[model samples]
Structure formats: C-alpha cells, structure tokens
Target: MGHARANGDRRVHHRVDLDGRAVVFQRGAHVGQYALENLSAGGAFISGERELRPGHLVHVLIDFAAGNPPMSMTGSIHRVREADNGVSLAIRFPVLSADQEDAIQDAVLRTLLRREEQAARLPLLVFEPRPRVRQEIEAEIRSFGLPVTSVESLDEAVRELEGEEVEYAGLVIHSATHDRASMEVVEFFARTESLQTIILPEPDGELNDMAKRLSTLPHVSVPRIWSRSELRRALRN
Candidate 1:
C-alpha cells in the first residue's frame, strides 16, 4: 500500500507500471473504466475523473497487458489525492488468497521480463533479521559456491527482488521472521511454475511453527536442521 503507507518509507512488495484499465464497481454498480497503473501483488492505483472516497469498498476487473484476460480483484480505497487532471485513488488489497497473489506477481514479472531485459544471474537471497543467524545462512550459501545477497528485513529483500540486476535462484528465510510479513513475501515467490526455490531454515526443538506451516506449499522447503546436503538440495531444487 505504498500510495497510502504514510508512516514510513518501507515497502515489502514491488510495484510495476502497467498499461492497464480497471472496471471498478461501487456498491455493486458499475463505475466504468478507470486508467490503471502502478500494479503490484499487494494493490493497484487507478485514476479517473471520478472521485472515490477513501474507505469505500470496490470490486475491480483489471485488464492488464500481455494478452491475459481481465483478472477480478477486490480492494478498498485507501488513499485519494487530487491531481491536475483528476483524482487518483489507491486501492489496498486485503486478505488475498495465495493463488491470487501469485497471479498478480506473475503478471508483474511478465511485464518486467518483456522489456528486453535479461534475467540477473542466479544468486541466493537470504532474509534473516538476526545477525548471528544471518551469518550462518550466508556461510551456508557460500559453502555451495553460490553468490549470496543477504538482507535483514522484508523491505530490503523486496528491493533486491525488484532490482533488474539480480535474478535470484533461491530464497532462504529464517524461521523467526514475523509470520504475516514472511508469508506476504513468500507468496510472491512460491509460484506454480516457478524456477525459484524457497527454503525456510527450520531448526529442531525451536518455536518455529511457521517453518513447518510454510513447508506445506509446493515450492517451499523446511529441513528441520541444516546439513550441507540438505541445504544444497533445497537451494538447487
């Protein structure tokens, strides 16, 4: 919700510019097409002459590019600002299902990849907020002769994922990350047809319930303890 997050400059999701349009419905009535831009898995920004009040609930059918059919979504008007031409409204998506988030993320990735861009060479992205744990993760990655880009927060990791110069091979997240925040980031990664691997370092005899919970997903792995072979298998899969 970059458009509405006024408290800080922190963004855990990546935003991409879109040549799209939104068919917004207010109170189940059609509000017609509004120009759509700055779409992310998290939310979208729509601009039109119509002014939607903040906190108004709306359903949207977004016509994103790349020959894909319109995708239905729901959001609330989180922020509104008057522009020289008209008003721009930002939608805050809430309680999105994992599938929905993955779809939007795929759409964003396609747009990014279609701009004559080359995928960045594979590197392991380690998101561990704890210092000692972060060091161990880095050492593990390097032991496999893999390049590592480690970060201590979701915001930093998202920055790395969105950057054009670094395509990640895998993501190794600590089990200790806040459950909500880690899942939000992980949903963007564990795709159905993903080439990227995601590993959650689930140490034994610890309060890492999230590690076990997330490992149920198709592309997420949770090795109870780290062994070079086990970690290597998770990273390469």
Candidate 2:
C-alpha cells in the first residue's frame, strides 16, 4: 500500500511491508475490518475504513499469517489521510515493555530477513516508466542496501537482463500480470529459475487475477508495500 522513508524522514523505527486483516475496535466495542499495510515496533499503518479519527484509541487483532494466532494490540491514531481509494490510518503505539518490544521487533525483522534471503547478495533491476516515480522508488531500493540499476523502459531492462556481466538479485516493477508485455517478462523470470521478482500494483490499483496466481511462485513477491529497507539501520537490537 506504500513505500518508506525518503530523506529527512524522522521515524525512529523502520516499517516492514505486511499483509493482514486488522479487526479494529474502539471503546471496547468491535468497529470494522481494515487492511494492515506496514508495521514496526513503534506503530503501524492501516487503510480501508473511514470511521476513525486522530487520537482515537483502538484495539486491533491482526490476523497476519494463516497458522498463527492474531496479535492483539492497543494504539492511538496519530494521523489519517484520504487516499485515492479510501482512508488510511497511522497508529502510534505507546512505549511497550522490553519483552513486548522485542517480540514486535523480532517479528518485523523476520519479514525483511525472509524477503532479502530470497534475493540476497546480488544487484537489482528496477523498471519504471515515469522519471519522478522511478527516482523516488530507486532511492527506496537503495535504502535496503541493494545495488540497483534503474531503467525507464522495458527495452532497457531487456538489454540488461540479456547481458552476462551482471547477475541481478531480482526485478521490481509496478504492473499487473494482465498486461501482455509485463507477463512476458515475468514468465522469463520463472523460466530462468534463478531470478526473483517483486510486483507492486499502481498506487490506486488493486492486484489483478493473474498477478495473485503468479505470487504463489517462490521467487515472486506480490506485497502491496515495499519491505522495510532500513531495518538494520533503524532498529536497535
């Protein structure tokens, strides 16, 4: 649902991209369900409902993975925004106990660790058409400590992939699998069997059917937001 810290970002903790359903509550009553976008030890952001306000205290149950029990937490809404599709929430948690903080931080760390392990110790290729958007995303990738080669067109990415001098960690793009050209490249990634890829839908977009299917592949990640690129830098162990 979003990207992370640019320059001058004062956030003390780094956020990891997470996919989950948040059952929200207020005043000890069930409120509604929302999509959990990203999370850190300090707080998290959720999108999809318009019935909340800043400073509102909420209790949430996060059903993150299939097998694990939902995590319950209490937080205060620090900010809110009206997005192209719906309202987004910024929830700030108060100071947690050492054990509580450790558990939360450890969980967030594992998410980034898992993603990087899938495409570790190698460079990355980012394909984006818009110059401004590409630059913003480029900086975000670099923040993760991966060497990135950003291209403005698919043709450029094609040439880079065909070359033998560099082995890429993965391919990052913002597109749906329904697009013929995009599908072809992702097919190539699967065919190669050695590459990994990440697909981020357009800012105001939802994932297409084919994209969801392709996400089942081990080398593919279809997360709505970029994983915390600054976990190591921002989190204190």
Candidate 3:
C-alpha cells in the first residue's frame, strides 16, 4: 500500500509544473479560463468554478513548451474538495504505456532541468464521463467538450465499453453504487490484458479512507494531479 507523505518530503509533488495556462476540464467542455496550480508525471490539480466529483473520468490536453501542438490523454478523478479560492481536484492517469510513461517522465524532467524553459502550453481540453457522472460532472465537462453518451446504469456502461472496437487505454471506476461491480470489472480486465484501473472514492470521501479502500487492489496506480501538463506527463510515465 502507498502512503501519502506529510508536507516536508513532497519531492514527487514538487516535480509538478504549475503555471496559469494549463487546461481546465470539468464537464463536457473545456474551461479555458481556469488557472493551473501544479503538475507531475502522475496527475494534476487545478482551480475552477465547479467541483469535480471523485471517480469521474477525464481527458486532458497538454502542450508543454518542449513540444509543438498539445497532446491529449485520459485520467480519473481521485479527489475533489472545496478550497478557499475554488474547488480543487487531484487526478490520476491510468491509460499509459511503458514507452509513453518514459517519454512523459523525460519530458517533465527536461522541462524541470531547463532554467529558461517556458511554461507548457495547454489545449482547451474536453472532458467526458460515463453516464452515471453526467449530472454532477457534466457542467465541468461542458467547459471542455461534449461527450459521446450519457450512460446511467451498469448495463449501459458495459454496452458502451463493449461496443468500442479498440482496446481502451484506461478505465475510471466510481466507488459509489458500483463498488462491487467496479472491482469485478478490474478483475475481468486483469484476466484479459494489462489494464490500469483508477478507483475514485465517492464524493466527500476522506483521502485516508479512500486510500485504504483502494490499497491491495491489483493493477491500479494513483497520482495526484494539478495541471494538464502533469496529466500528460503521467500518461507517458
């Protein structure tokens, strides 16, 4: 099981590159106005009007200074809380290959190693979620882009996953009503291939409690996100 360190040794946290311009994805659209705070090879945290519910799925766009056009990646919401300025979200990316992860880490490390590197540019971004999250996360997604569907039940969600001809790079499982189903899904994927699953705690869930619930689960990884660049970096990592 992984443990969240106290304030002193947040080296991993420091790796996050936070500038004002990172993309903000909340609902179906990208909110280009929200400012970024920090980012790492794992995920990102951002400032925005609406609060993202835990366990939601999101796609992030990152255009770091080292690269040309922004690239997009998928991630899952790990935490969302009310802060003094606005709502804050901590996300983790699950759809990444070893080469992709290495590339992202190299990109982030290069950006960090350079003293004069400009802040990474970010895309307006588009956020889409499985139907269950539409009501709570839709407003946030609209700030990014529109979704393919609004699936509200397990049967619908399964159908959506099965209909696709491509192998998914990631999966976001809500820890609400589908807790058992989510676990079963993860096991199913593990038996078939190398799939990374992001387990989101229900809204209002304490991080400590959420961590414990997800601990010991196989084929899962968690990263605290603060920027779109960070989310992209995570995909490469």
Q: RMSDs, each prediction?
A: 14.6, 15.5, 21.4
Model 3 residue 49 lDDT score:
70
Ordered from best to worst lDDT, the candidate numbers read 1, 2, 3
Write down the RMSD of candidate 2 (Cα, Å). Answer: 15.5
Model 3: per-residue lDDT, tens digit, 1-237?
132332112223444563434565656687554455656656767667767678988766765655523546678878988888687777676555445455556666666656322212211111124544544443432333322233555565555556655334445444444545545654566446445444444445423444445545565544453233333333333
- For each candidate, the alpha-carbon lDDT, in order, equals 0.74, 0.71, 0.51
Can you give the TM-score per candidate against the true fold? 0.45, 0.48, 0.37
Off by over 4 Å in 3: 1-14, 24-28, 31-33, 65-69, 116-237
Tens digit per residue, CA lDDT, model 2, 1-237: 132432113236778777677888899998888898988767888998565889999998887752334678889999999976788898988755555566666667666776666556667787888888678767877775667888877778888888998878777776642366766777677667546677766555466766666667777766554444322221111
Is 2 or 3 the stronger prediction by lDDT?
A: 2
Error of 3 at 2 (Å): 21
Model 1 misplacement above 4 A: 1-11, 117-237
**lDDT, model 2, position 184:** 72
